[model samples]
Target: MSRVLVVEDESAIAELISINLRHAGYEVTIAATSDQAQFEVDRVLPDLVVLDWMLPGQSGLALAKRWRSTARTRELPVIMLTARAEEADKIAGLDAGADDYLVKPFSTNELLARIRAVLRRKAPEALDALVDVGGLKLDPATRRVTRDDREVRIGPTEFRLLHFFMTHPERVHSRAQLLDRVWGDHVFIEERTVDVHVKRLREALEPVNCARMIETVRGAGYRLTQQVQALSN
Candidate 1:
């Protein structure tokens, strides 16, 4: 059974989450404070965390930041719950390392849907351990990249960046979107950092002659194209 930790300072809110999670056949643990939540996380690493944005003593954002900094919990899935529904607040939550965000007054059905989506995305799947698009082939299991069967070595961060692009091919992604999708929403890295990773990814692809696969759209952001565009002579 999947285990979930619901970290909310409000008792009623916590009960609501616990009840729904139990109804969904999940083992639920409740933590009313950030410190207790951390302790629970240490004692029993949950499959996912449903964290409130606001909490006494330490806020949910702080807890999410802490989790991202710790090696053990860095990859843990988190869905942030917040009463703040403004765009800025959502961005802030995402920037703090949340995998997803739930605004206040959100329906139980939507909350459950978000939880399932996050878990599904994180779950291991039986896929082609290696996916080839254009000349680039990426192995999800080994995290190895190859071009035309020639092995290419890339840093962990760059590998993740490339993997995300390959899996989500043809879609133009803003730096913020890429950051949230590839680096987890709770990461506090600057949006400009995405540019740095893209540069490194391009450099790695240069030797393989696949560097043109990553396209930058002026005024927009970046995308990975399967069809290699021919340059005019």
Candidate 2:
């Protein structure tokens, strides 16, 4: 299942799209502001973005351009959704690296079609592979985590949760975002379930002396980071 992050300010519009996307078997998340959208993207890279043209703080155009400039999100497929049908606006959006463009008052059928087309155009990567971060190693092939020549026992869910964190180390992930990514998008699990699993993951790593790396960002979310080491300028 593909994950989509819809960045729309209007609650009605966001809900409408989310409902439709979910019905179509696409895992969907709705972000109502530029800040929220950016935070969501920072948490996990969605398969595709349905971005609104006008936003409250930073314009959608600016957000798209910024994502293009950032290495992590550079190739992120985006479909600009806006009421601005002017040629200039479309061209600007295209220049901003939008994979596709859809004018508002658009039909849900067309929107779904466009999303499918964009996804087909985007290249896919191997999700199962060896990951190593800060001396902690996880091998998807072996389904094992090892540190300092010692094996770490972890549950299936914890293994996957830890895999996501290790792969995206040093970035904050909100419970909602983690649930969408780690637990399948359409999963109806509670947000607190994420906290419980995170705690379990930490306890599993405690034996390896790597538990302190997962830091809780009060009022925000959690992040996996390397041990603090001062760098010389």
lDDT of 1 by residue, 1-233 (tens): 56799999989988998999899888899999999999998765777899999999999999999999975577789999999999999999999999999988788889889989998887654144466666578998887898767888799999888987875555577898888877997577998999999999999988888788898978778988755634310
The sequence of per-residue lDDT tens digits that candidate 2 reaches over residues 185-229 is 757789999999999999998888888878899988998877431
Give the distance in Å from residue 106's predicted Cα in candidate 1 to where it truly belongs. 1.3
Give lDDT: candidate 1, residue 16. Answer: 90
Q: Which candidate has the top score in lDDT?
A: 2
Clashes of each: 6, 0
